[model samples]
Target: MSSPPPLPERVSAVATLDDPVRRSLYELVSQSPVPLGRDAAASTLGLSRSTTAFHLDRLAEVGLLAVEFRRLSGKTGPGAGRPAKLYSRADGEICISVPARQYDLAGELMAAAISESGQSGEPVLDTLARVAAHAGRAIGAASADLSSALTANGFEPRAEDDGGIVLGNCPFHRLAETHTAVVCSLNYQLLCGIADGAGDAAHTIVADPDAGECCVRAVPVPQIPQ
Candidate 1:
């Protein structure tokens, strides 16, 4: 279709942000739809304003935050102490979702793949191309939107010269430590729509979960957990 938005040559993930305070700041940044100020976030997270400010600044230091300047109190005039600093999850931060997709969205990718390939064909290439094309189409659209959506959730998809993508940042690493399977699966679905029916005309799907780290689009999803 229309050659799609130039294929982005490369894409990357967020840079790692390692720290408790900064991580917390990242969490807050991911919550509110609009940007937030340190004071407002302090109130929400039940932390002192100064503490919030410290954490927010630290998060910004690691490129996990999107900051902007705003007059916290116009009534006080320039006569008052320094204006308050605002904090928020950068405009395109990533978040550790509580299953935002009901009934596992990845299921759809598998279903589509299976249903597409579970057929009879004289020449497999024809069937494979159709399947790959369909899956790739879905991934193309999803990735386009995902770049922005993942940012909102606390991630940054940067580009890499290497055949694939990497995360330059990941705020949910801490929150998601326990759910690597689900998170890993999410990554696989992405690759599914990415590589789909790949390989030398034989049409093969990647069966390794962590393979997405490479550009091959090889992550595998178990048979949809019953």
Candidate 2:
């Protein structure tokens, strides 16, 4: 599965729809049972083909619309002419929030946990912890560094003078507020997995919940004497 766009990208893509013409084109294409060609869209909106095509392409550039070329006529290659460009709504979801909420990520993790628990006969919470950690590990491994990984996941990581890290925002803030114990535990496990996957053994993730911040902190790992 593919990850959703970063918050900024999603916000920008959504902002493109603020244009009245573009918004109308998007609505028309999305609501239609089938993809629409530029000519068809132009006729329906009472606009010139050039104007409609420009706005449609603009929407596609922002990832709000999908584009494909096909021959509207049910004819073969003999002399079918050029394929028409059809536009439709793109796949995937776009969500934007001021503080950045990731209820969708939380829901995905929980759903996976439930499915695995049902199959393996394991406790749901235990399965949830495992899956969340696995997800974090993937994020860390794919990112260029720890900070990038955290930022990508909406953790909003900040570096401390002592070489520690503080999370300015919790992606799962809403869920954590309602289900403190479960969500916090999941948060800790996920961070630990991120550290492991990032191959940064110097940091240890600990639950140190504070108001308006993530429930966990990344502190320097304690040294062990041989």
Spell out the clash pairs found in candidate 2: none
- C-alpha RMSD of each candidate structure in angstroms: 13.9, 1.8
Model 1, span 1-226: residue lDDT tens: 1121221211111333455666666776777787788777888878998887877776676556767776666656567667656666654433233223212233443454456566653343344444445654455455434344333323344544542334444333432356564444444444344443222222233434343222223212233465
The sequence of per-residue lDDT tens digits that candidate 2 reaches over residues 74-112 is: 787889888999999999678888787778878888899
Highest TM-score among the candidates is held by which one? 2
TM-score of every candidate relative to the true structure: 0.32, 0.94
Task: Highest lDDT: give the candidate number.
Answer: 2
TM-score of 2: 0.94
